[model samples]
Target: MRLSDYTRLLALAAIWGASFLFMRITVPEFGAINSAFLRVFFGFVGLAVILLALRCPIRFNGKFRACFTLGMINSGVPFVMYCIAAQWLPAGYSAVLNATTPLMGALIGFTFFAEKLTLSKWAAVILGAVGIAIITTFGEAHSMQELVFGGLACLVATSCYAVSGFLTRQWINNQGGLDPKIVAFGSQIGATTLLLPLFIFTSTTDTSIHWAQGEVWASIIALGVICTACAYIVFFRLISDIGPLRSMTVTFLIPPFAILWGYVVLDEAISQGFIFGSLIVAVAVWLIVRPAKQAEEVKALQS
Candidate 1:
């Protein structure tokens, strides 16, 4: 990979890593559904502005359904899942779980996309499973019940991301690749549509809403504009430059930054189980990422 690509990867990891911090800050004040709605809603606004400035046609480029599906699975579902998780898990905990994306991606490839699973990948999966076990069983957290539910939510969210990665290669990249702005904008639009009613219902019913707090508002804008919108653009560029397989390496780098942010911003302490589990998950991602030489071939398999 080129130095610039490496820089983009690290930068993407940092932004996404901080998403956990932002969510942790905002979700409690606004509640999960409302917070997630704000995220996609603002993400749509940010991407729309970028699309206008770039003069990229906001209209679909022959793949409307695909873009919408990608958004619903990738952004809509996962955002809500993570928001719910943020209610219980610390930022670093959720970030480490995010590293499971490649593991889930590899599993999806092997099962549905006819990709070969090397022995290393099998070992990686086992290691990842073991890492998750250690984290869930032994990690430092307040409540075991909350930890279990939070961990499960994070897993489901990453699985959605893994599916979206494959779908992006199939539905978008193979069709000569949509402009990154279009994909980002369309996805956020789809997410916003899915979230709007939920946001409204929660706003009406949830008495805990704290729309007036400065921290709450700041985290909301940062989560949507910077983390979701800008991160998507950067991620799509990395996929264009380095292919999706290599683009996924960002997951491995996210946890440290997340742990750092948690420690500094939230005063969350790191435990040995968290450290060990995180290392194992990183190894699993590295192993899965190593053999993905052709992303399109793996993602778009014929029956």
Candidate 2:
């Protein structure tokens, strides 16, 4: 990777790592519906500006439903689930748990899409589960029940992300190299639309929760513009420059940075279990994303 790419990696990791912290701090005031709604709404606006500035073609031509479906699974559902998880779990906890996205995808792919899994992948999935167990069972968290439930919520969110991978491959990829920026913009719009009713209901009935706080709204804007929108731009740019395999390596950096942010900002204690579990999770992700024999052969020839 070039120095500039490395810079992008760091920025991406930092922004994503800080996302959990933002959600943890703001979700109480914003609520699940409100937080999820604003994130996508602002993300759509921010992405629109970038697309317009760059003069990127934003085509819809028969892909609206596909884009909306991707948004529902990829962004909308997962955001709400993570918000709910944040209500109970620490920011660091959810960030670490988010690493399970690839693992969950591997399993879901095997089961639903009939994707062939190597022995290494099968073993990696089992090991990933063990890592999750270590974090929930041994890592510092709330009550055992809350820890379990919150962890499950994170798993559900990651699982949705996993499913979206297949959906994107089927719907978006089959459409002749669709621009990811367009897909991303469509997704934000879809998520915003999906959350409209919930946000409205939450705002109306949840009168007891205060909404006048400046810091809370700031966190919400940061979540949308910086974390969701900007992160996606950086991620797609990395993929264009370094290929998806290299870009996926960002998965390894997020948890530690999240743990650091949690410790620094939230004064959340970092324990040995977190370190051990995070290491295991990173190892498992490496195994999951590592090139298979066929891919390595193809890549060798291409290179």
Candidate 3:
């Protein structure tokens, strides 16, 4: 990767890593529904502005179903799930739980999409699940039942993300090289539309439109513009250059960074189990990406 690419990687990591912190802090002030609604609302506006500034074609040729479907899976449902889960689960733990996306993605691919799941992939998935269980089991045990429930919420979020991957592959990828900016644009709008009722009904009681603190506004803007809009741009660029597996390596590091940010900002405790589980999760990512590396090498050799 070039220096520019490295820069993009760091920026992407920072933007995404900080999103967990933002969600953790901001969700309490604004209810999850409001926070999620605003994030998507501002994200839509930010992307729309960028599209206009860059003179990118924003034309929608009536592929609303495909785009809207992906929006719900890729953005709408997962965002709401993550937001709700963030209420009960620690941000760092939520981030760690998300590290399971590739494993879940692999399973979804194999089961539904006819992608090959080799022995290595299955082994990696098992190890990753155990790693997550370690963290889930070890965290704040007011009751074992609560921990289990929290853990299940995280798993549900991961599954949402995983299924979204297949949705993206089948719907977006097959659409004659559709511009991802378009997808981003569409997804945000779709999410905003879906959240409209919740915003209207629930937000009236639990949410405040007034920004009491500048930090809150900053966090909201950062989540929308930097994390959502700019981060997606960097993400698609990385995927274009490095392929999805390499690009998605960000997932492994995100939890650690989220944990680190939480510690620095919120004085969140980092347990031994969290550390051990993180290491195991890292190993699982290495295992999953190994085949993608091999595939890239083979392609280079053939070329």
Candidate 4:
């Protein structure tokens, strides 16, 4: 990768990693559903502006429904889940758990999509589970129940992400593929639509929402515009320039940034157990996602 590509990759990871911190900041004031709704709503608006600026065709070629439904699963549900976790888990904990998406993807693909799972993948799945258990057991939380629930919420979010990946391939990529930017824009629309009624209900019923707080609104704007909208543009560009495999290295980079931001900004404690669990999860993710040809080359060298 060129220096520009590397720079973009780092920027994307930083943006995404900070999303957890943003949620942690906003969810207390906005509530989980409200925070999620505003995120996709503003994300939709941000992407629309980008589309207009670039004069990109808004055509979905009759795939708007698919794109929209995928958005609900990909963005809407997962965003809510993470927001819920933000109430209990530290931002760094949530980010480290988010790294399990690839492990969940491997398992989901094997079970539901008929994708092959090799021996290494099986080990990865086991190790990932172990890492999660360690984090939950040893990491700080308000209570045992809250810790378990928060951890489960993170897993649910990652599972949604895993499912959406396969669904995207089937619905969009296989069907002559829409522009990635359009797909992203459509998905945010779907997410916003899905959360609209819930947002309304919460807005009316929850009188405690801190609507006038500048910091809360600022976090929401950054989460939606920079983290969701701009990150997508950079990610798609990285895929185009360096291909998906290399671009995916951003996943490995995100947790460190998340941890750094949490410690530096939120003053969240970094326990030894958190560090050890994160390392294990990182190894497991590498096992699951390392390219087959690269693995084969390493094996040959060892032999």
Candidate 5:
């Protein structure tokens, strides 16, 4: 990989890592649906402005169907689930569970998408599962109930991400490669539309809605512009340059930043179990990320 590609990967990691912090800040005040809705809405506006500034004309055909599917699986459903899960799970724990996205993506690709899985990939899945088990079992000594539920939510969210990634790769290849900005815009717009009604109903209670807090606005703005808009751009660019599996390395780094934000900003307790579990998860991801023949074949097809 080129230095520039690595730089983009790092930037993607930072943006996604910070998403946890922003969600933590805003979700409790705004409610999950409203928080997710505003985030996608702002992100759509930001990307739309960028596209207009660049004078880039998007070729939007009947791809609205595919785009909506991607948004539902990628952003809409997963974002809400993750935020809901975070309400019960620690931010750090939620993030660590999210690190399983790549593994989930790989497995889904191998099964449904016909991207063959080698022994190495299977081994990675095993290791990743073990890591998840350790984190769930040891991370909470008193009650595993909430943690288990959170972990399951995270897994479902990760699976959603995996499906999204495969679909995106297909989209890009079919279009002879597209501008990342356009893809980002389409997904954001789709998510905003899909989530609108839910936001109105779920966040109706006055006590649940805190639209006045400056922190809430700050979190919204940061998540919209930085995490959603810019992060998606960086992510697509990274995948285009380095391939999807390699681009997924960002997941391993996101947890540390999430943990840091939780500790420094929220003053959340830093438990040894959190540290140990995080390490195990990271190692498991590394095992899965090692180059696989099937992934290599998929990359070749893309090229």
Candidate 6:
């Protein structure tokens, strides 16, 4: 990867790491559905402005439906799931759970995409599951139910991410490929569309939404404009420049930044279990995603 690619990767990680903080701030006031809907709604608006500013035509090349469906899987569902998790899990805990995305990807690939699962990869999967169990069992929560549901919500979000990655490849990337910006914009449209009815329902039904706070709106805008809109643009560029494997390294870098932000900004306490579990997950992810040539060399040496 070029130096510029590395810089973009770190910037994307920082931006995304901060997204959990934003969600933590917004979900309580807006509720999960409303917070999620407003995020994509503003994300759509921000990306539209970006396209217009760049004079980029908004064409999906007959792939709008696919992009929309991808949005539901990738953006809409995952966003809501994470928001639900934010209600109970600390931002740091949620971020650590999200580190399991590649594990989920590996499992989904083996099961559904006919991808290979070597012995090492199977060990990685089992180790990743153990790491998740450790985090969920030990992480702080209001109750056991909250801890279980919160952890499960994050895993569900990551699974959606895994599915969407493949779908993006099959539907968008492999099928003549759309511009990343256009794909990002269209996906936000899809997310917004999917969440609108749920947002409306929650707005009508939930009496606890605290809409009068200015900081909540500020966090929401940052979540939409910076985290979703700008981060997607940079992430797509990284994929274009360095390929997905290298781009995936951003996953490894997010947790420390998230943990730091949680500690510094929110004053959340870090426990020994979080530290140990995060390390285990990180190691498991490396085992799963380490380059094929490197894995081959290690096996050859052992043989």
Q: What TM-score, computed on C-alpha atoms, does each candidate reach? A: 0.94, 0.89, 0.87, 0.92, 0.91, 0.94
Model 4 TM-score (2 dp): 0.92
Number of clashing pairs, model 6?
0
How badly does each model clash, as a count of residue pairs? Answer: 0, 0, 0, 0, 0, 0
Q: List, residue by residue over 1-303, the lDDT tens digit for candidate 2.
A: 799998888888889899989998889887877898888888989999989999998886778888887788878999998899888888788888898887887889889987667788898898899989988887676678888888999999988877777776677665554677877888888888899999999889987878899999899999999888878767655655665445656756787788788889889876788778877887899898876688766864686
- In candidate 6, how many Å is residue 237 off? 3.3
Candidate 6, which ten residues in sequence have the lowest lDDT sum?
237-246
How accurate locally is residue 210 in candidate 6, as Cα lDDT from 0 to 100?
A: 68
Q: For candidate 5, write residues 1-303 as lDDT tens digits.
A: 788887777777777878988898888787777888888888888888888889989765656667666777778888888887766766778888889988897799888998767677788888888888878877743478877887888899889888877787787646576677777888888888889989877767556465779978988998998898888888776666676667767877788788888788887765677677777778778877765568777886796
Alpha-carbon RMSD to native, per candidate: 3.0, 3.0, 3.2, 3.3, 2.9, 2.9
Candidate 5 wrong stretches, greater than 4 Å: 140-142, 205-207, 292-303
Model 4: lDDT of residue 224: 91
Q: Between prediction 1 and prediction 2, which has the larger TM-score?
A: 1
**What overall lDDT, based on C-alpha atoms, would model 1 receive against the true structure?**
0.86
Candidate 4: stretches off by over 4 Å? 1-8, 236-249, 294-303
TM-score of 5: 0.91
In model 3, what lDDT does residue 29 have?
77
Off by over 4 Å in 1: 291-303
Task: Using lDDT as the measure, name the better of candidate 2 and candidate 4.
Answer: 4
lDDT of each: 0.86, 0.82, 0.74, 0.86, 0.79, 0.86
lDDT for model 5, please.
0.79
For model 6, what is the alpha-carbon lDDT of residue 263?
A: 84
